[model samples]
Target: MRFLIIGGSGFLGAELARQCSTARHEVAATYLTRPGETTGVEWLPLDVRRREDVAALIAAFRPEAVINTASRSADWTTTATGAVNVALATSATGGRLVHVSSDAVFSGAAIHYDETCVPDPITPYGAAKAAAETAVNAIAPTAVIARTSLIIGDGGSPHEALVHSLATGKGRGVLFTDDMRCPVHVADLAAALLELAASEYHGIHHVAGSDAVSRYELGRLIARRDGLDPDRLPSGRRADTNAPGPIDVRLECGMTQQRLRTTLRGARQFLA
Candidate 1:
């Protein structure tokens, strides 16, 4: 199957490209800033905010499956509107589209969320992700919205990097104990996503890890795995530090477990 991975240079996107390429699938990936070479994956420059560019790329590449991994963590225009533009463009192609979503879509008031749960975002990032999910569903119902949590792996992830920095006193920050996430392994999430892209699964799917852990705990786990001093990672409550942020956004993956052949291990389990 032919695959298109938007923002393929990113952590999760890069993993997806590598896995797909290893599986011997025709792969085309997009990059915005960081450029790197991955064998068997064609990298292209694309700004998802530009509809014409998206259309043009799809027209030329003509992939059977399109995965939108492009995201702007802080920018509203690029995060929300950019995703909508991708949905509209992908809708035109009639190809299978998998919009990589975030567990941040939830307000974190609830402990567990399934596909049927309503999105009640509390933060700007959460709001953007929720908006993108709505737009993608409305514009392209055939598209699969894979809502995942903190992507982590042994290879220096953002979370891992932060842990390592704090462990060595290179970075100074408080790890939040109140904030909770699933924290799926990049390899596991990417493998499951690739399967979904090839299949005809529609609507939102919780494609995350098996364990739910606090941000602070996740950091400690990474530190422990990498042989760093977890004591160096100072822990703080999100409610105490800043305004009460999303406390817990744990995704229920019963459907995903039964549906996909791929197995998503827990962050702690995978790290070990």
Candidate 2:
């Protein structure tokens, strides 16, 4: 299958691209700033914010599936509007689309946010992610909106640096005790996404790890795993801060697990 990974330059996107390439699939991954971490897959310059760029890529690759892992993350323009553009492009092809979404879409008001739960984002990043999911649904309802949790790997993900820095006392940050999430290994999530791409599964899918742990616990675990002193990790809560943050958004991923052959393990198992 011909696959296109948008924002392959990022943490998750690169992993997805790598997995597909290893599976002998023809893969093309896009990047905004620099070339992605993957080597086997074809690299292309893609900016999801630009319609012309997206249109041109679709015309060039004519992929069987387009997995949109692209995002400016906390930035609204690239994360929200950029997703809409990618969805439109995928719609133009009438191909299978797996739009990589985040669990941040929820406000953390509930415990079990199943696949059917309506998104109520709290933070700006969360709001952008929610909008991105909505845009994808509006543009291409057939697209698989896979909402995921914190992505971690074997101490290699770009997202892990902040935690490592704080654990070593190089950075100062408060780890959340009340804020809970399911952290999935990038490799596991990437594999599941590839499997979903091959399926006809549409609508929102909560693809996350099996373990639902707090941010503080996750930080301490990360610290211990990387040979850093876990005692340096400071614990706090979302309720204690004036800043906007989600409290608990643990996705009910049993439904997702039943659909795919791939197994999603917890951060504890993977990080260990």
Candidate 3:
């Protein structure tokens, strides 16, 4: 199968590209600016925000599937435009698409969210992502909507950023105990996305670790695993006095794990 990964330069995208290449699939991954060289895979300069760029990519690659991991949710306008461009590109080619979303789309009110759960994103980033999902679904009903949580692994991931700060004795200054999330490994997530791409399954699915632990606990685990002093770690504070971050991001793995043979390991054990 020929696969094209949007945002293939990012950590998760690179991991997925590696897996697909190892499987002997024809893979083409797009990057925003500087593209990295990957063995057995073709790297292209792609910006999903541009319609002409997307059109050219489709015309040239004619991929069987296009996985969209590109988003500007950090900036509302860019996110909206980028998501729409992705939808148009895939819809035009009548190709399969997989849109990567975040668990932030949830309001964190429910103990656990299923595919049928209504999106009630609180933050601007979350709102934009939820809107992107709706737009993609409208354009291509068969497109896969994957909602994931904080991803760990890779040297430059958010998890690694925290670790680097702690190792340098900077994280001891502050930590958010109230802000908790289930951090999934990038490698595991890549496998799940590939499985979904190969299947006829559609709609939203959660791809996160099995454990839902507090940020403080996660810090201690990472420190302990790396032979650092766990006691030096600072406890967490609320993101705001009244507004607390999400605590339980525990996702119930159904289609991703069962049918795809992709298992999201518990963060506790994985980190340990």
Q: If scored against the real structure, what TM-score would every candidate get?
A: 0.97, 0.96, 0.92
lDDT of 2 by residue, 1-272 (tens): 99999988788888888888889899999988888767789999987888888988887889999999877655898989888888887788777899989888888878779999999987888899998888889899888999999899877775478788887788887888888899999988999999999998899999999999998899888888888888888888778898577788899898889999989999888878
The local lDDT score (0 to 100) that residue 69 gets in candidate 3 is 83
Off by over 4 Å in 1: none
What lDDT does candidate 3 reach at residue 225? 74
Q: Write the per-residue lDDT of candidate 3 for residues 131-211, one digit (tens) a residue.
A: 998898898899998888888773558776786587568764456676668788888888899989988989888888888
- The digit string of per-residue lDDT tens for model 1 on 1-272 reads 99999889998889989998898999999998765478999989988888889888988898899888878878887889888888877778777899999988888777899988999988898899999999999999988999999999775589888888888999988888878888899988898888899887889899998989898999888888888888889888877766645887899999877899998888879877
Global lDDT of model 3: 0.80
Candidate 1 global TM-score: 0.97
State the C-alpha lDDT per candidate: 0.87, 0.87, 0.80
Give me the candidate number with maximum TM-score: 1
What does the lDDT read for residue 164 in candidate 2? 88
TM-score of 3: 0.92
Superposition error at 42 for model 2 (Å): 1.2
Quickly count the clashes in candidate 1: 0
